[model samples]
Target: MSQLQDNFGRRFHYLRMSVTDVCNFKCSYCLPDGYHPTGKQHFLSLSEIENLVSAFSQVGTQKIRITGGEPTLRKDFTDIVRIVSDNPSIHTVATTTNGYRLAQHAKEWFDAGLRRINVSVDSLDPKMFYQITGENKFDEVMRGIDAALTAGFERVKVNAVLLKGMNDKDLPRFLNWIKNTPIDLRFIELMETGLGRDYFQAHHLAGADIKAQLQSQGWSLDIADIDDGPAQNFSHPDYRGRIGLIMPYAKNFCATCNRLRVSAKGKLHLCLFTESGLELRDLLQHPDQQAELIERLHAQLAQKKETHYLHQGITGVTQHLASIGG
Candidate 1:
């Protein structure tokens, strides 16, 4: 009875829990300029987050990922991973970070039974780095990536957001970097989020053009199947690891999307693109209403949009990417 299967006949198994709306780095594509952080009232306590994740586990939720403004900014990050890891039905507990804090937090989270780590690093150029993230700490991110490697995160994946005129020219370089190093690389097409499209309007490089660029570079990569999550993975012919691509405009995967996002404020979002969400903060107040909350959640889940509408993140909601839980 807990199974809320989607239109694709796939059970929505993965829960992307956004721990906090506080991110250290404000990337141009993600948050843009003048983006203010969220207040404390919007955040869910460690206990509340763990309790909800635990309930989802009872209903056959096996995968949970912690995201945030930057998940590492949360003090209880490691505990969140630990709590989810201990759940019997939860097969994987992962987090996607900006990697700035990974240098210190990597081993701790890894020891807490975290299964995977995804780092968002769009470009390799340091000067371009400043223009993109408004932060001169690109070196810190690289160091963090190395730390994750040293911490036993054998397959740390790098998420690169591709823009038509901006970093799209570096597709060859990204592939070469993967071929040379042990790190995993994935290309993400830029979404016209309310904040992103408003400030940044560079042409969005299509997926086919991206594919052609890599193929023309003579890179032989194979596709990897890691659920219907954003990235469509591709591996080099003789490489040790693979590369991934998550296309929004060219190839939207909303059809097979089994993702559910929980905002930092305790709102359970059934679809990333849709503004509709079920509030869990009120439900948490009356613990007796837990079953009612679950039923409401299931109803919302079934109505998960086939995919996100492309006018971008114009929900009139002020929640930034940090609060959106990525």
Candidate 2:
């Protein structure tokens, strides 16, 4: 099998594939105006996804993270999980969701073969959660988390995008809440996208500050696996839960890049802020085309840049986080 490595020698073993771009949440920093369909939303079909995953699995991909506006929105979500988990080479099959459907479908998803789950829970406070996500389903989402735990998902994670004056001060609250929850609560630094320029300016917070605070309070860094996501995880002896920080703005952040993203439309994104994507939908038409698809991916991987130019204020074609399952 050909290794997925770039010119910089960064090998990719993880794939973040988006099943759809139509997110239901209207998060202030992401889809503040809510999701509006521009035209026919031609997301990848189940067969196409099967072929795509098969090709990636052939080329040393060990972990797959299914992302979307909210991947659970798809009717075939469970089937998606089942097929992805069926691949022997892919040891880990995970999905990131909004937590609205977990209460009703967590067991079904778990039974379908999904072993890891990450849910977006921006604020612990009900009112503040509504203020950020523009949805008043805090209680329901909480119930969904409980359901996920009951469904035997030991690797549950919650994500919160750190906003400077908004939820930044809520760290202590998050810390206290997760003391015994056994969840990995991650705080992501706000990235500047085409649609969230003004919002980013107002709310962008340094993840380093939070990491410093965690270190001061005795939270020690945790050892990460080869295919783990970009977050720097930390743990404390007394707490059952863990904390993670994703600092994209930090130096050498891309040195350990191990994941590649494919958008819902089957466009391959070498980087989160790449100028454009390489189309792969046509290659996914048949399972016989697997070799050609892998060839295309490998050829493109060689051209991957050393690092993203986010510091230079180039967000590329990504208008918002929901557009490509950020």
Candidate 3:
């Protein structure tokens, strides 16, 4: 089969699938405090998910990243991982989680063929963690990080979303924590997703500022050769692990975008900020119609916007990061 490419000539090789939208932590920037999950029936069945993965694989998707409001919240999360990993065309199977329950399942997930894990840890301070996530599980999350490293996964990444006057000051703490460990620490720019408009307005920090701060602190950083997704990785002279920056605003990497997202509800989102998507759940239920669905998906990809206008005061399409599988 021919490789899938968008109109802009970027080849699609990565797929991020949201297994479920249910989350335990009410992250200030991700989901609302009173957010409710869709009915169980709304989620794609295990068979449906596998079929979708197969279809994507057939179209040249080489890497699959399983995401969710909290992926580990799903009962069959491991099964989903196994299904994606079993695909011959899939070279990597990774996941991004809140790390609330990773300690209990990191070994299981690794056994199920999960290649890497990215844990979201915005704050090392317990009080700040509670304030950001509305949960007092900071200790548990720390344990989860330890568990992931112990599980011996190929790569363990710690993702910290930099918010001005929020967790931005915690950079030194993160650097100190990861100095002896091999876990890559990534600082992500605050996105203007619609759900957190007020919070975003109050605390959005640019990635450039964070880099400057690190440089001023006498940390020598050199660009690392690893390019996993959109993050621009850098290695420190004194630390064992590398640092990454995902700057959606300050440095747009959309020109080389090569991934597509599938919502838990089975919407094929061509871009993170796109307001429209092609519904795909129904097509998964009918194997005979998969060809048509693939064709439609390609057409949709061709129509993907060249670049997002978030820096120009455009609000993100999806209401919350959870809904879009962030």
Please state every model's RMSD to the true fold in angstroms.
2.7, 0.8, 1.9
Q: Which prediction has more favorable TM-score, 2 or 3?
A: 2
Each candidate structure's TM-score, on Cα atoms with residue i matched to residue i, is: 0.89, 0.98, 0.94
Judge candidate 2 at residue 24 and give its lDDT.
Answer: 86
* Candidate 1 local lDDT, 128-246, one digit each (tens): 77777878888998988888888887368888877766677776666667776787787777666545554446656667677776667555655435443766666566565577777
Which portions of model 2 show Cα errors greater than 4 Å?
none
Summarize candidate 3's per-residue lDDT along 9-92 as a digit string, tens digits. 888888999988888888888864846856554788898898899889888898899998788988889899999989888989
Supply the TM-score for candidate 2: 0.98
Ranking by lDDT: 2, 3, 1
Give, for candidate 1, the lowest lDDT window spanning 10 residues. 311-320
Give the 10-residue window scoring lowest on summed lDDT in candidate 3.
219-228
Model 3 scores a C-alpha lDDT of 0.84
Best model number under TM-score: 2
Error of 2 at 16 (Å): 0.5
The per-residue C-alpha lDDT of model 2 at residue 154 equals 54
